[model samples]
Target: MRAFIFPGQGSQKVGMGTDLAAASTHARELFEEVDDALGQRLFQLMREGPADELMLTENAQPAIMALSMAVLRVLEKEGGVKLADVAGCVAGHSLGEYSALCSAEAIPLAETARLLKLRGQAMQRAVPVGEGAMAALLGADVAKAEDLAEAAEADGEICTVANDNDPGQVVISGHKAAIERAVAMVKDDKDRWGIKRGVPLPVSAPFHCPLMRPAAEEMEKALTETVIVAPSAPLYANVTAEAVSDPALIRSLLVDQVTGRVRWRESVLAMHADGADHFVEIGGKVVGPMVGRIVADAEVMSVQGMDDIEALIKSI
Candidate 1:
């Protein structure tokens, strides 16, 4: 069995899909469609970036999703691979979930792009700049990270584990002070917590925490108006870490995902438990390594450009 997983934020680049768009007409058309939907030449921005504007949450969110979908379309149209037939279940990291839903036809491509644009804008505006922050808890598991997060909270400041990515990797998000406190606690008590170091993340705002309630509310309004259908492939939700086929549940979980932990490790384990032996990381190569760490015995592959698509096809 095979599982298809998509990547989230932090995987974007200045010229993400330029090669693919140049190589495949399908890929180019998809990019054109997205640009038309958003009423902006996003592809141009993606291909030639000043870095700052493309790095904006609003831009990165939709841009990454568009590139991922472009890669998937290339695989389907040029490589003769069908995601709905090959992937038993699908999962994604944070924003990657939107890509998965779009690839599976659960959500319209244009709607997904627009929703992510709103989501990115909302998340960016949720907390004032310098007021919130995020950090990566290296050499720490979820339980240990949670304990460190609780110990790091200062004066009721919000600090919590955001992404349980792999065995020794976890991310935390919250108030800037609390994040600093968490890193300090881990630095001072590394032996007790088994934390190597808490490295601060270069992010616009603290995401996947209570501080993002405003973003969640904004998503609630946007998702309510958008049409969603059941995905052809079951999606292992980031909030629940379980496969869900119900469209209503997927929508609710997406709303919750704005302020919920990305249970990636558990979701990968669940897919493995269901007899998935091959894991395909679509959109970006970042999540592919984490999946390999989660299920050591499973075959892992990442599909990004034309070479990656050919390799993935050959591997299967």
Candidate 2:
């Protein structure tokens, strides 16, 4: 069985979808439609970037989704592969969930783009810059990362594990000072913590933690008003790390994901356990490496440009 996955934030670049748009009319049309839906020349920004602007949370979220969708559209149009017929399941990392849903036709492309823009804006607005921060813990599992966070967070500061990415990687999000303290603790107490390093992430806000409750509330309202249908294939939710197909359940999970840990490691393990032999990364290569760590024996492929897509079609 083949499983398609989409990448989340931090996977975007200046010219990510340009090659796909150039190679496929379907991809170009999808980019144009997303630009129209957002009422901004997002494609232009994506094509030519100063790097700083494209990296902004408000811009990066939808930009990542747009590239993923554009790639998916090209695959569908050129490869003669439809989601319902070939996919055993679908999943995405963080905002990539919207892309997965769009691939499964659970949500329209325009709605998916608009929702991501709003989600990014709300998440950015939830915390002031430099006040909240996120950090990556290398050579540490979720349990050790949690202990490090607990030991570091003092004076009522909030710090929690945000993403359980893979076996040796975990990310923590919380107050900037708390994050710094966590880094110090992990670095200072090597024997006790068993953490090789704690690297701070460049982000506007501390995401997927309790600090994002305001963002979660905003997403709840937006999702409630948006139209959602049952997906063609099961989507492995970030919060649950399991396959879910019900529209209402998906809505609830999306809202919760704002302040919940992204259990990507377990999600990949679950898909691999269910006999998904090949895992195709649709948008970015960020999650592709993590999938490799989770299911080393499974055939993992990252599809980016025309060559990669064509090769994927031939391989499948």
Candidate 3:
């Protein structure tokens, strides 16, 4: 069995979908549709960037989703492949969940684009700049990360584990002071926590922590107005790390995920345990290497451009 995965933020870059759009009419059309939905020349910004504008949360979220969907569109239309035919399950990292839902047909592309734009804006607005921060813990697992977070949560600060990415990496997010405290603690005694080092992330806001309650509330309201159907393939939700096909549950989970830990490591393990030996990463290659580390022997492929889509078609 095979699982289809989508990458999250930090995977986007300038000229992300340029090659795919040039190679396939389907990809170009999908980019056009997303641009039309967002009412901006986003594809142009992506193809030719000043770098800073495209890095904005509002732009990057939808831009990443658009590129991922473009790759999927090329695979379906040009390669004559259907996602439901090959992937038994689908999953994504952080914002990539929206891409997974869109690919699974649970959400329409236009609606997905609009929702992501709102999500990005809301998350950015949730915290003031410099008041929040995030950090990556190298050579640490969930337990050690949680302990470090607990140790750093002094003076009622809100430090907590944001993402359980893999066996060797975990990310934490919270108030800037608390995150700094966590990093200091790691530097002071890395061996005690079984971690190598703590590196601060260059993110706009501290995401996936209690500090994002306002963002979660915003998502709850937005998701309530949006319509979602059951996905054709089961999705291993980022918050739950379990396969869920119920539209109502998926909606609730998506909101919770705003301030909840992204259980990516557990989600991958669960998919592998469920007989998904092959993992196909759509759009970006970031998540594929993490999957490789999580399950070393599993077959992993990341589809990005025309050649990748064609290779995937032949493999399937």
Question: For candidate 3, what is the TM-score?
Answer: 0.99
Q: Please report the TM-score between candidate 1 and the true structure.
A: 0.98
Candidate 1 lDDT by residue in tens digits, 1-316: 9889899999888988999999999999999999999998999999999689999999999999999899889999988998997889898899999999998999999999999999999998999999999999999999999999998887889999999999989999999999998999888988999999999999999999999999999999999998999999999999998999998999999999999999999999999998888998887899989988888899998888899999988876
lDDT of 3 by residue, 1-316 (tens): 9999999989878988998888888999999999999998999999998688888889999999999999988888888898988889999999999999999999999999999999999999999999999999999999999999999997888999999999999999999999999999999998888889999998999999999999999999999999999999999999989999999999999999999999999999999999999999998999999999999989999999888888998898
Runs of candidate 3 with Cα error greater than 4 angstroms are none
Each candidate's TM vs. the true structure? Answer: 0.98, 0.98, 0.99
Clashing pairs in 2: none
Task: Report the number of clashing residue pairs per model.
Answer: 0, 0, 0
Give the per-residue lDDT of model 2 (tens digit) for 254-296.
9999999999999999998888879999888989899999888
Candidate 1: count the clashes. Answer: 0
lDDT of each: 0.93, 0.92, 0.94
Winner of 1 and 3 under lDDT: 3
RMSD of each: 0.9, 0.9, 0.7
